[model samples]
Target: MNLISFITKHSQLPVKGVENTVALLNEDCTVPFISRYRKERTGNLDEVQIAAIVNFKAQFEALEKRKSAILKAITEQDALSAELKSKIEAAGDLTTLEDLYLPYKKKRKTKAETAIKNGLQPLAKIIFGQRNDEIDYEASKYLNDAVPNEDDALEGARHIISEWINERSDIRNLIRRQLERFAMITTKVVSTKKEEEKAQKFRDYFDWSESLSRCPSHRLLAILRAENEGFIRVKIEIDDDKALNNIENRLIKANNATTPHLQLAIQDAYKRLLYPSLSKEILRSAKEKADESAIQVFSKNLKQLLLGSPLGEKRILAIDPGFRTGCKLVCLSAQGELQHNETIYPHPPQNDSKGAIKKISSLADAYKIEAIAIGNGTASRETEQLIKRIQFKNPIEVFVVSEAGASIYSASKIAREEFPNYDVTVRGAVSIGRRLADPLAELVKIDAKSIGVGQYQHDVDQNQLKNSLDTVVESCVNTVGVNINTASIPLLSYVSGIGPKLAENIVAYRNENGAFGSRTEIKKVARLGNKAFEQGAAFLRIKNAKNPLDDSAVHPESYPIVQKMVKDQGLALSEIIGNKEVLKKIDLNKYCTESVGLPTLEDIIKELEKPGLDVREKAKVFTFNQNIRTINDLSAGQLLPGIVNNITNFGCFVDIGIKESGLIHISNLSDSFVKDVNEHVSLHQQIIVKVLEVDIPRKRIQLALHK
Candidate 1:
């Protein structure tokens, strides 16, 4: 299929409109530019659709390049047939084409090549043909070969015939497919060194066997961990009888007289060559699949963490906990405005306890703070204790905010813009406070993977991990929407059409010209262009501003239509926005099209149903154990309440007031079989559990779910 048509057929975007979009991207036009101004040309494809087209187009071009490479590789061997060349050229994926080319590709010297060079090719062919009862005759024909000095020429011919069977691509392919189907992955301890005794985590993996599809990512990763630590040698195995019989069936006819010898040769080939090669391929496939799965889990956790609710329109004092260097404190106004910044050494400051207490108390009093946001960092708990001791007449609530990616955000360009004259440490404190106030907006500023919300995140494929995480962020950002006027560059950057550069431009424009009066006013932002506005406008909110619908998710293009709907109800836009009667009367199909479907229209209707509503409310605070600091402190049968930080295929990790989270295995998630942990528990969910077991030295805590 032609690239544009292919994209149209496969993509969730408008096909015909994206053609021009793709051309612009190919010409190096940025997403921001095309999404904003070229709406009429693209039939109003937003930033998301435009970006999808760009990605698909690049992939299409790469496939063409791969096809050319495959043809060149085959043509070089002078064995390219018209039909094979056409088939390879038409192949969509590399794996399919590679399977077709496997036989003809250049290879290392094999026994068949040796036999061919030794002039036993004729005898080898005769036996491979499986002719009627002619094994002895075929062996006699090989007597003149250099190895013919052996007493039995027939035995020599058998060896040559065996090599031929091994070299046949059809035979190898049949064997590989059969083995993959029947194979069971076997993981075992190497037992080569005493190191495994010290590797307690791997002791349980001494001899684990799992079917390919049923093998979970975490389990595979565990075995890989053992292998990396030099504690285990892992293997993939197929039933020997099944594997051998499949190969024999393909190579030897049932009525053939030489079937026994062919079976022996096939068995020998499998032992010498096929088993090792196919085993490695299976392992590689299994690893790739496992990595994909792990990346998905990590992506889900990161997304939920990044999209955690924001405490909208609240003044906050965010403190980044520290000891010798001292804690950095920054206060933000109710509108996320930076009001004050300072440093306080709650520990070792001026070597006086009274002075440290006075410093933080004064700042809290001056800021009229409602909540004290303490960063969960190196000296977090100590900082929490310090805040608790200073019991104000106001009795402010203390929240231990995760400071996972605060440092990264603080050093980022957006941070520099937000706190131009402030040091990175000072910016970090502001970030921590803002995170408490608006977790989603503040966390979006940091890299999703760096959020520390998932298991083995750093070990997964970074690119795949990044893509999955970005998708989650995109979905979350779009779902919640952003305020165009108040959103930071980092927050705006993730909105539909708006990206890093465009988001910066919008923020800079706002800084230079003041708050956006209307979502349409964003067009004035330098370099934002049309594409940026089209994608971003629908997501950005303009509170209590001109055109009340602007504060809602209803896009500017759909504003008139909504107004028309409201007018049809004999009312103005504001009168009908929150009125259930007016909303019920509106038909989403009136606005539905190939570009903006019923789903998009329904979302707009829902937004209007709750106009200018703040999505973030106080999420239920999870209780952490007061005594437990880590897994080592836990014992069996101890019940604890903790926040569910992440969920995976095999288990859910509960941060039970400890540095290390305890795992509730899948079997424990419910009395029934829990196929997916995410279905049972979500990120930030509070759960109670009983400690099933804890290995003190290993620092592993096994937990069981509480009803």
Candidate 2:
């Protein structure tokens, strides 16, 4: 097969485009680098398109490997023929490949092998041909040594015929299709664990049955989890009569002398071999599909969370709110460096309310805290209220940041290296503050999964999840662009081709030699060679650079073109930067070249229009309904404002100032039919929702968007 052309056809991209993309990918060109810098070569394919090509290329390579193994296995058996070779080569998917190799695959001794050992092969072949009239006499003739009677000889022949029917690829394929379309997924509570408290959480799924095709991703994940926990039994099955009828129609050639034997073989094959095997295969494939869907949703949510609004570089006072242990507070510099730390007990127990207020006010004044970030943990609401009651010398923007992964980050190796002198609480407070100042920068320091916003993340394919989440982080970082001078090692690591080691090198180089003055200077970082620099430079923003475009997203390779444009227009490069009027005057077509087409040229023009622009909107304060403090405080028909904290396939969880977030089901997302919950709300989206149902015993709250 012409793999390049096949990939091009499957991806629906131009042949030349896919060819060039594949070439670049083989050359180790990163997706962000190719999409941003090599637009002309890829026909202006975005990151998503380039990644799809990468995935397809990997898939094709895997298929080729599997085909080679099958060919080798069959040839070793001395059974490889031109027709068999052609079939194996033409096999499209794994299912087909496995089906074709099934007859060749080695297995333990079965009834069929035993029957063949006892000289029932001739009788089996005669029965399959259906041309024999004296089948009983023929069976009696073979019943000499091992075969004692006609019944034994006939049963052995039936076993051999069953194995033959099971090996036919066409029959397997037909039955697989039927299973995919008509399989029913049913679950039942384990008899012994039915009344367990943990099992009650999965009560809805305990005695439920649904068509596998109609099962939603979230619901399927839930059922699988219940089954995995041993609280419920799960089974996938289809109507046997229908399945058998279809299989027989495809296998049985005619209704003749051997018709009864063939019918018996077909029934035995389906019941004993086919159904069990195909059912598992169908369920496994369905689960993988569901996993992909859930992972996509998770990747989207992680991207949004990582790219949440940045408050820019501001001196932030962060508090990891607590009651008995006190609110661990730390003041962070604009660059996210820890300057001071303290503990204030403002809630309950040590209600050193006066001292806490005075201490907070003094710290805000001394540190010149621009924004106050309180980690939304145990005593977040109380801490926010405490800070609000006190007056600072300057206007301080108070933000209750989601401390989803703060604790994890606090105890992490990255956090330890950054704050060796401080403890976990101080590190956590710093994370909260840094998250408020620049979410993308601080959040990258923690594991993507630990940051939350995924359904059954642990249950999905782990390696696939990591790769996907990493892609999302890379995309978000490149799209927003990172300040090289201020970015953490983790944030820098996500910038295009910069891996963990390169990020550390960049940080070390900065530490040794102040800050980067130009994008060109990045090459000085240890091991950040031409290729890595070429892939990474455009995404890393160097503020106060000698060249204005260096601070912008325009690649350094395109600097000569920008200079030419400025020279032709009789203007300095600075005059063109951020001057939309001057940028509009220059014709982008004039700058387009063979290597740099209209796509890159237009992008350069856009960058010149708003040089060094931060694409993220400014962070705004979100307030939860003050009347409600916890889930127990919630009531039916109470309308309250909340922030969308986590979104899943079923619905989004809204944080209405409590530990238990209310879930707004898909049906309640709008008065109309909402097919996708994401279409109605997004992560960190602030909106008002009316309380629909609050089950105090189960600690579940159902919410609906106000009509």
Candidate 3:
């Protein structure tokens, strides 16, 4: 199929770029590594483009595998022919190939097989050809003990003809086209479950009908979930008469005795076989497209959440707030190590506000806490207000972090391994603190789905979702460049070319010996071969390494080029690193060679300008309006500050310092058409929103973007 050309055409990328990227992928180069380091070979393809190539390459391989299996199965059936083989080989898609092989597939007992057993093939063929005028006489000749009458014999012949019509690729394709273009998806509520409290969430889709092609991805996923949960019945419908007439025009040639038989056969095929098979196929194709769209949205959101602004390496005092159980508090070091843990009941039944304030102030002073991270969960607003009243020795920046998956992380196996003596509350508080300090390093320990940034995540394809989320984590991890010495097993596992096993080995070696002194020292770990090092060394940074470039993004193979540039300029490595004036004066063309082009040289210069500099912005403190605390307190047309916590194709959900989050529909996002919700707002972005509507009974709040 000329796989390279096929991939190039589909991906719409340069042919050479696609080919070279495929070659590198074959050599086990990761997307992050190829996009960052192999710019010359891949024609400067970004991570998204390289990922597309990888996906298309996997698709091509899967198609080829399916074709081979089909060929082998047909050959074993002794039904392979030169023309059929050529047709199957030329088929580009799985649907076309399966259609061509339908007639050769084995099936269980059917009426057609029974009719063929009764010697009715000749009569069926005669009737199908439409050349026989004496179809009754021909049918009578085939009557036997099993088929005692012409009526029975004719019915058998009709069954055989129906089977023949159903298996024709041309007829299936015709029905497929009709369904793809004209099908409507309709849903009906199950009478018994309609009044259930749980089913009220899907009440909007109870009696809905829409064009399947025009239905949005989120809506389709919702309807499908409803159907799966037995709250509704879904159906795909098209015009039956139109489909039958189209098949008749192609199959029936004349108006004779066989004409009526052909008409019946066509009707049976359209009703019993063609419509059912092709309708499901079209719906499945639509579902897959919807799944892809949802996954893309999810992956984008995950990237933003993982790379959210970090309060870099600050000693944090984090609180997981609660009302009756008290707030679980933990103090973390600059490196996110748990130092002390306790509980404070500043709010209600045990209103020991004075004691809580005294304890918090003393702890902040004793641990040198620079920031306070309060989890945005139960009693979060009250806790934030209480913390503001406390008088600390230093001016501490208070940040309210999203605690979506903190509980999940606290109860996980990873948490258990890290803290065997601590309870889930303490671990949860620690996670909240670490997330504020370095989100990427701490969030990788939790599943992306549990982070709650996506919509209908559990409804999508699980395997595809996992692969996509993993890719995003890997890309973000490599892009920011991991601190190899302090990184946990989860963080290091996402580094380029390092899997779970190798990450464990590295950690064990470090615990047994000491921290990695340089990039070269990574090779001393058990079974970390050259290939792994080649792909991983550039992304793993050693702080204060003897060789300065080890902590930068420059690959080891290109270390000589950086050295030559430094030597040519007659400056010490220390003076040249982070010296933008000295770097800007150096001529990049002087270092360009066959392997190293202008792109690589320019990248090297930029890295030296800011060695190991974090690409993410610094975290800033945010405050929600104090007047609004719940749905009842909100009013229409009131402007309130909020944070964008979750985004979807429809719109984004904002936390307005309340128990229920308000939603801003896409239509209200701007004055113009909103093509993408992300273009208007991003995850964790702070903005002001006007309350549009508040339904206290349903616990729903609709909002409009005010800024």
Candidate 4:
């Protein structure tokens, strides 16, 4: 099939839609740009659907490349029969293609090749035909120096027949299907490493046995990790007798004297060839599936965390909490510029609460701090309690934020460039505070994997994980529009079609030329062209510009349409913007043109109603039970408020005011069956859960969600 036909069949999208999408992608259109602006062309396909089509198209092309290479290799060997060529050409997936080419594949010499060289081809042919009456006589006639006796000749004949059975596509395909359906995975601890300290974490999986198909993605990854570290030995297997019988029924012709030779050949083929090769392939495939599942989960969690609630622009005081190291504090303006920095020790070793409170209150008064953000690391609870006790001029909100990856960001090149004079501790405090004000803007500076809201992140394929996480970040950034005037370079880099270099140029132009007064000024940035503007204009918002549409998602290319709407309504540009009653009453179809269809018009109407609106909810304050500080404080059946910190295929981890997060398995997410843990819980979602069990030695805590 052709590329468009193949893509259409797999994606279930219209032929025209697939054709247009492929054309747009080939022309260098980004997913966010196409999904937002080219809705009419793609039948309103979302970014996810468009990305799926692109991935499928790439796979189809790769398979074709592999097919060409295989055909060339077989033809070079002078073994390319018409029937073989036809079968290879008709194959759909890699497995089928590889199976069809197995017989022609060149390999090192084996018993079968040796036997064939010893003049045993005729006896093997006779046994394979299974119609000869004098099988022993046929075998004896093949004796030579290499095969001195009838027994030796018969053995060689069986070896040759075994290879013939092993190479048949029909037999190999059936056996592969069987292995996929009934394979079992088992693990045992290495005797020498059983009591080692490093292996203690995987102790529960030492003697684990589970059906390969039913294993959870996280569990399988953990098992593989154990095997990789030499703590356990893993095996993928099926019933040998059943597999041999399956081949016997497919290959054996009849129950005659030759049947005994056939049975011996079947056993030899299975033991020596078929089972070992196919089992390895099955394991590799299963691991790939597991990797995909885990990566998808990580992607979802990262997206949610990146899009978490923002507190909007506000002057803030951020604190990186510690006991002996002291809490590093910084004051930031609404634009997140550092105004002041200091270190305060309110927890033990220097429990001068009165002096610390005085210092914090004086800084708040001096800098007009509107809110307080404290990192949820060592001594966070005490710092929060102390902040609440202080009497300030205004009621400043206190938020306990996750400090994961903050240190990584502090040591990063971005942080060093942004704050050349400040220390790493000061930079970390600033990031903590900036994330509370606007998460998407500050998070883009740090690596997604270091954010710590995922499971099995370090174990998954690195390139696949990066692609998935980058897509999620790109999607989130585009969804919540960027402020072109005040956004940092990292934030601007995620705008469609804009990479790091262009983002830097945009920032430099703004710095030299002042804030962007109009959207047209963006084109003046060096190296920016028409294509980049077209792809990135809609997602980049300029607040309070000379033209009102510039602050909204309305692309400048559609300026004529907007002007027509304003003239028809007999209203000024500012008057028509944010006029919900007027926008809601207007019929978009009357203004739809051949170039701008209903999809485009509908989006314009929506933007006019709520110009430059943020889709994320406002940040909220959550409080855990004061008495519970760690797992030791938790008791069975006691309910406590917590926030989800990480999610995996098996369960989610929650922070219930403890250093060690608690686990609520999929079974305990709700009373009913839950096929997916994310359906019941989300990243950073606050809820009440009951403690089910706690192990002090292992530092494990189990929780169950309340009804």
Candidate 5:
């Protein structure tokens, strides 16, 4: 198959774009680098389109590899025929290739193999022909010690016939089509596990039935998870009689003495071979689709969470709130460095609210803290109230940050390396403060799945999930443009071409020397060759560089073009920077070349307009309903402000300043159909919601968009 044509048709992108994108991918260019810097060659394709080409290219290669393996295996077996080889080579999909290869695939000893060994293949063929009315005579002629009687001989022939019918691609395809159109997935609770406490969570799937094609990905994943847990028996079924009739119509061409034998063979083939094999194939296909859908959801959520608003380099006093153990407090500098650590007991056990207030005010005044970040965990509300009571020397904004993966980050090796002397509590507090200052930088340190922004994260394909999350992190990091001097190893690692080793080397070089004064100086880092620099240089920013374009998204390869533009305009490079009036007056067509087109020139102009400007908004202070502290305070029809903390296919979960986050179901998102939950809401978006119902015992809250 023509891979470029295949990708073009599938992605619905321009053929030239797909072709050029694939070529660039083969050159080992990263997605961010290609999409951002090679717009001219790629016809201005975006990151998503380039990534699709990458996926399709991989799929084509895998298919070709499989085809070669199958062909080689068949040739080694001396079963490769001209026609058979053509069919195998022409097969575009795995299903078709495997179906064609089914007849030659080696198998364990079965009744069919045993029958064929007994020399009943001839008899099977004769019976399959349906030309002889004397089947008994033929069976008698084939009788031997192994098949002592005509009845046994006929049974053996039928077994061989069943195997032949099972291997027929047309018959298998017919059954597959039936399954694809009419299959229903049903589940039943395991009788032994019916009353188990762990089984209650999946009780909705107990004795449930749904059309497989129409079943939502989340529901299917849930059912599969339940079955994996041994809490339910999942089955995929179609109208058995309808499916068998369709196969018979396609296979049975005659009615004679062989009619009954053929009917028996058909039934055996349908039950013993076709249904089991094809049903499993269909289920697996469904699972792959579900995995892709879940992974897309995860990737989207991770992107939103990573691109979330940053408070941006502010000195912060962050607290990991608790009651009996007291609140763990850490002061962070504007650069997210840990400055001070202590414990403040303002709630329960110690009940030193006065001392805590004094300490917090004094610390804020001393550290010049711009904001306070409190983890939304145990005693959070009490701590917030206590902090609000304190009259600070300066006005301080308070943010209730999500503590979903704070513990994970705190206990991570990276955290330990950052703060060797501090314990997990201090590290966790520091993470909260840094998250408020810049969410993307701090959140990247923890695993994306542990961030609690995805659905069925553990249940999906692990490798695919990791790759997708990593891509999102990489894209977000490159989009924001990392600071070379201050970015942590994890943050620097996601830059276009810099992996962990290069990131470590860059940091080491910086420590040995000093901050990178220009993009040209990055080559001095150990193991950072020209290729890595070419792909990674544009995404790494050097603030206050001698060459100002180093801090912008413009690639160094385009430096000459920018200099020419400045020279042509008869102005200095510094005068042209952020001079939109002058930039708009210059004709972009003058800089167009064979490699650099109008697209590249336009991008360079845009970068010069606002070099290294963050695409994310600044973080704002949000307060939950002060009167509502827990699930009990929530009531139907009450309007409350909430933040969208997590999103899934079904809906988005809103944190309404409570222990249990309320779910705004897809149906409740808008008056019309909500095809995508993201279309209605995004992660970390602050919105107002109307409480629909509150289940205190179950600790579930149902909400609706206030609008």
Candidate 6:
């Protein structure tokens, strides 16, 4: 079968769409470019569909590389039989390929390799043939003072056959499959260690075990953490007798002359060759699967966090809370322009509260601020209260934004560009305000992993987590169009085809030549290649473009079609925009072509209905209690309103006005079998819940979404 073609057929996208997009993506076309300008080229695949195809293409390429390496390694060892070569070539998984390559792989000298080198090849073959009449004679022919008696010669022959059994890829594959099915992961606490303070949470994990398939990612991560911290040892175990029986049923015969000899050989091979290797492989595979699952969970949470309520182009007062160092106050105008910057120490500006209030009020009244965005870091709540105590009849609404990566962004090159005249802390205040204005655009300036909404995010494979987060960010950026005039280089870089250099070029071109007149003008940016232009143009919207539709997310490719639709309706672009009747008459199917499909056409039509619509909703004003700083504040069955910080396969974590969020396990989701935690709750969702249990010392809070 044609592998790429086969994958395309099963994939969510059209075969030609995936194939053509992969080709372009491989040749350096940016995802945004292909998604926006190359609609006709890729059958109108959107960024999400195109990204999926690119990932699959990378996977297939990696698999092909591994296959070639396996084939070459075996052929070089002269162990490549015609049938074996064919089987190895046909194999898909790494596990199966490794199985086929086992015998050919270079290894440390073993008993079997030594015995084979001792000139007992013919005798070993004779004994394997299992001709009862010749077995004893064959054994006798090989016997010597060095070999001892018949039993000794027979034993030597068994060793060779055992090695062959171990070498058989089919046997190894079968055994691995069986172990995966029957094995139970058993975790144990190391009683040997004199326990330290931080290792206490893991103390209970030292002697815990669960089925490999059923183990939640968080649980596995916890156990792995304990092991790393030297608090426990973990192992996976299965019944060896049952495992042997399964193998014997497939590879050994009961009534042949070689039966006893084969059993001995097979048993030895299982111990010497297969079991240890397969165990390690299985554990590694499980860990990788677990990591991927967890990273995906992290990615979802991060995406939600990044796309959380935009402060909606409203002027905001930003406070990067500090006590001894004084607060960094920055005011961002509705258009994200830095209107004013200053510092006020409500806690210590020489312990002068009157002066601090006067300064804060002066900045607020000067900018006519609609709300205050306080970074939820040190002294954040105190800062919020200070702002709230002010006597404006309709006081500014205050929100506590997660400041996880705020400092990182403040110290970044992008931050330097936004605030060249201020300190890092002031830039952080600006970030907090901008984050309230548009989280996705601001968070992209910081590393996704640094956002800290994930479980064992640091412990998992770093490269894998990065790739997943990158995909999520790319998807989010494309989904929400960037303001070409207002977008920073960091936000611009994530557009489908644009990289750091191209992003800088676009910004430089804009700075040098003034604001972009239209999305098409991005072509003038230095080093902004055709591929980059195609992916990035549509997403980089110009609010006051030469064409009104350019401000809307209607791609350049769909412009002519939309223009025709507007003309046919006898309505101007503004007249029909946000009008349901006129939009209903615009046939989405009429625009469908080999390059543009129903999905892209429909999406374009919707974007036209609400031009430059902020995809994120406004987060509600949640009043958190000061009393519940930690899990110890909660009792069983106690009710509390909280924010859903994260959702994983096993459960959801709710920040119930506490330091440690409570877990709402999957079982408690609906009093029914909850297969996926995301189906019930999502990141940053406001939820009211009851605390089922709280182990203060362990810092484990079990919560239920019963309300």
lDDT for each candidate structure: 0.74, 0.89, 0.92, 0.89, 0.91, 0.79
**Model 4 clash pairs?**
none
Summarize candidate 4's per-residue lDDT along 1-707 as a digit string, tens digits. Answer: 67888788788988888999999999999999899999989989989999888888888898899999999999999999998888888788899998888888897998889999999978898888887877888788888899999889989999999899889888888778888999999999999999999899999899998898888788889999999999999998899999998898888878777889989999999888898898888888888889899999999998899899999999999999999989999999999889999999888899878889999999999999999999999999889989989999987989998888899999999999999998999999999999999988989899999998777788888988998889889999999989988988999999998888999999999999999988888999999999998999888888888888888888788888888888888888788888887777777788887668989888998888888889999999888898987678888899999999999888999999888999998999988899989899999999899899998998999999887
Q: In model 3, which residue pairs have backbone atoms overlapping below 3 Å?
A: none
Which is the winner by lDDT between candidate 1 and candidate 3?
3
After superposition, candidate 4 runs with Cα above 4 Å error:
117-119, 140-152
Instruction: Kindly indicate the candidate among 3 and 4 with the higher lDDT.
Output: 3
lDDT tens readout by residue for model 1, 1-707: 57887678668667668777877776555565455545656777876787678767777788778778878888898989999987887676555666667666677887666666667666656666777486665566556646564334444456666655555657667767866677787776766753645666678778778786577788888788778778878778778787777777676765666666666667777887778877787778777788888877887787667667555566678888887888887887987788987777657644445676887788778888877788877777677777777857676677777788888888988788777898999888888888878788888878887777766676677777787677678767766778887887778888877778888888888889888888778888888777667667877888779788888766787776677677777887778878887798787777656566665567677878897676555643333566776666778888888777777878888777666778888998898977778888888777788999887766778898898
For model 2, what is the alpha-carbon lDDT of residue 88? 90
Between prediction 2 and prediction 5, the one with superior lDDT is 5
Candidate 3 lDDT (Cα, whole model)? Answer: 0.92
Instruction: Please identify model 1 stretches exceeding 4 Å from their true place.
Output: 1-68, 82-95, 108-120, 132-170, 190-193, 196-198, 210-213, 254-265, 323-326, 335-353, 410-424, 586-601, 614-616, 619-638
lDDT of 6: 0.79
> Residue-wise lDDT of candidate 5 within 1-707, one digit each (tens)?
67987787778999888888888888889999999989988989999989888888888888889999999999999999999999988888889999998888999888899998899989899888887887888789988889999998889889998989999998888988888889999999999999999999999999999899999999999999999999999999899999878877876788878888988998998899989999999999999899999999999998998898999988999999998989999998999988899998988888999999999999999999899999988888899999899888888999998888999999999999998998999999998888899999999999998998778988999998998888899999999999999999999999999999999999999999989999999999999999999999999999999999989999999999999999999999999999999999999888888998998888889999999999999998998899998788878999999999999999999988877899999999999988999999999999999999999887889999988
Each candidate's clash count: 8, 0, 0, 0, 0, 13
By TM-score, highest first, what's the ranking?
3, 5, 2, 4, 6, 1
Ranking by lDDT: 3, 5, 4, 2, 6, 1
- How high is each candidate's TM-score? 0.83, 0.98, 0.99, 0.96, 0.98, 0.90
How do the residues 265-368 of candidate 6 rate in per-residue lDDT, one tens digit apiece?
Answer: 77887887778878777878888988988998898898888778776788898889888988888898898788788777788545666787888888878889
TM-score of 2: 0.98
lDDT of 6 at 128: 61
Q: What is candidate 1's TM-score against the reference?
A: 0.83
In model 2, the Cα lDDT at residue 61 comes to 91
Candidate 6 weakest lDDT stretch, 10 residues: 1-10
